[model samples]
Every structure is written in structure tokens, then in C-alpha cells.
Target: ATATATFTPTATATATATAMATATATPTPTISPTTLTVAPASGTYGGTVNLSATLTSSGSPVSG
Candidate 1:
């Protein structure tokens, strides 16, 4: 008498994943109680005087 045999094959699978990110912006604070100065504190009649001002915001200089 005689006998027979058979064979089989198999397969595998793979997968991958990714992550995302986000960003946000911050705001600046405002300045208060500004100051001004003059070259001559007081002037006589028909006299010329010079004046100027100092501006600041949150302790930082502001763009013109």
C-alpha cells in the first residue's frame, strides 16, 4: 500500500501611526501715565523753549 501528504503557506501584515501639533500667540500689555520734559522749565515773555516726550509700553520701546 502507498500514502500522500500536502503543504500550505501563510502571510503577515504591518501598520504605522503619526501625531500632530498646534501653536498659539501671546499679547502685549499697554503703558500708562506717560511723561514729558522741557529744556526750560519756565520762559519769559517772547522767549523760545524746547519740549519732548518719552513713550513706553510694558517697559519696552514702541515702534514709530
Candidate 2:
């Protein structure tokens, strides 16, 4: 008479995962300053009288 049997084994566990990244914001562009003025505020001429000046940007009036 001979009979003996015993066995026990159980162990398994694993978990790991993560991610984070964020960045978005860009806006910066401004330029203003362009003028040209000329009138008959003070002038003294004889024989020829013809003067004119006009140049603007934010007002519309500029052509290359």
C-alpha cells in the first residue's frame, strides 16, 4: 500500500501604461506706422503751383 500526490502553484500579474503631452498657442504679428502730409499751409510761388502728397496704410492708399 503506497499512494501520495500533492502540487500547488499560481502567481501571475503585470500592468503599466501612461502617456501625456499637450502644447498649442501661437499668435503675434502687428505693424503700423506710415504717413505723408503736404498742403498749402504755407507756400509762396509764382509761375508754377502744383503740389500733392498722400500715403497711408491703415487708411488704405499704398501701391508698389
Candidate 3:
């Protein structure tokens, strides 16, 4: 009489991954207070004058 037995099994695994980046700060812009007016204040003596300009911010009238 004779008897024999054999069994084999092996397994190994490893993994790693990482990434990170953060840094932000940007905010600064505010300055509004302007007013300008220019029109036909006066013009005489053989001349032709035509001028007009008016711009405001707090008064509510600023267009381009």
C-alpha cells in the first residue's frame, strides 16, 4: 500500500496613489465717484461752436 498528497497556492498584491494641491486668494477692486459736465458755456465773435458732454456715477447717467 502507498499514498501521496500535494497542494500549493500563493498570492500577493500592493498599490498606492495620492495627489493634492490648493492655494488661492484674489479679490480687490472698487472705486467709483466721478462727475464731469461741459457744454456751450459761451462762444461768440465770428465762430461756430458745438460741444456737449455729461457723465456721472452717483447721479446715475454714464453711457459709452
Candidate 4:
């Protein structure tokens, strides 16, 4: 039946896509390419400078 045939291909494509995505996702997480930011790029050397740094990957904070 045409209905059954259409359903079969759609199911196949979905399964294939899901399988490929799962296979790629679990083994390899793309968390590289990070950004590092430090507050107050310049400060007086002798004075007390409260410096802090934040590291992020893909706009998400990287856990310390």
C-alpha cells in the first residue's frame, strides 16, 4: 500500500538519523574551542587588584 510504503521510508530515515546522531554524540563531545576572560585587563602593580577569570566553551561556563 502507498501509505505503508511512505511510512516505511520515513521510519527508516528517522531511525538512521537517530542512530547516526547517537553514535556521534556519546563518543565525541565538542567542548573544545574555549574562551578565557579576565577582569580589569590592566591594573596598578603595587595596589591590590582583585583579578578574576572565567572560562567558557560555546558560551557555556566550564566547570572548575
Order the numbered candidates by lDDT, best leading: 3, 2, 4, 1
lDDT score, candidate 2: 0.77
- What's each prediction's TM-score? 0.38, 0.31, 0.32, 0.43
lDDT of 4 by residue, 1-64 (tens): 3554334444333333333333444576565799999876566888766768999988989997
| Candidate 1 wrongly placed segments (more than 4 Å) | 12-40, 61-64
Q: Tell me the number of clashing residue pairs for each predicted model.
A: 0, 0, 0, 0
Residue by residue across 1-64, what tens digits does model 2's lDDT show?
Answer: 8999888888898988898999998988888778876666445665556787788878877776
Of models 2 and 3, which has the larger lDDT?
Answer: 3
Predicted candidate 3 versus true structure: per-residue lDDT over 1-64, tens digit per residue: 7888887877788878788989998998887898987775568978977778899888888999
Q: Would you list the C-alpha lDDT of every candidate in the order shown?
A: 0.62, 0.77, 0.83, 0.72
- Candidate No. with top lDDT: 3
Q: By summed lDDT, which 10 consecutive residues of candidate 1 come out lowest?
A: 31-40
The CA lDDT at 53 in model 1 is 52
Question: Cα-based RMSD of the predictions, in order?
Answer: 4.8, 7.3, 9.0, 18.1
Which candidate model has the greater TM-score, 3 or 4?
A: 4
**Residue range 1-64, candidate 1, lDDT tens digits:** 6877776767777878888989887988774654343344566778975565556555655557
Clashing pairs in model 3?
none
Q: Which residue runs does candidate 3 get wrong by more than 4 Å?
A: 1-9, 23-37, 42-53, 56-64
Candidate 1, residue 4: Cα displacement in angstroms equals 1.7
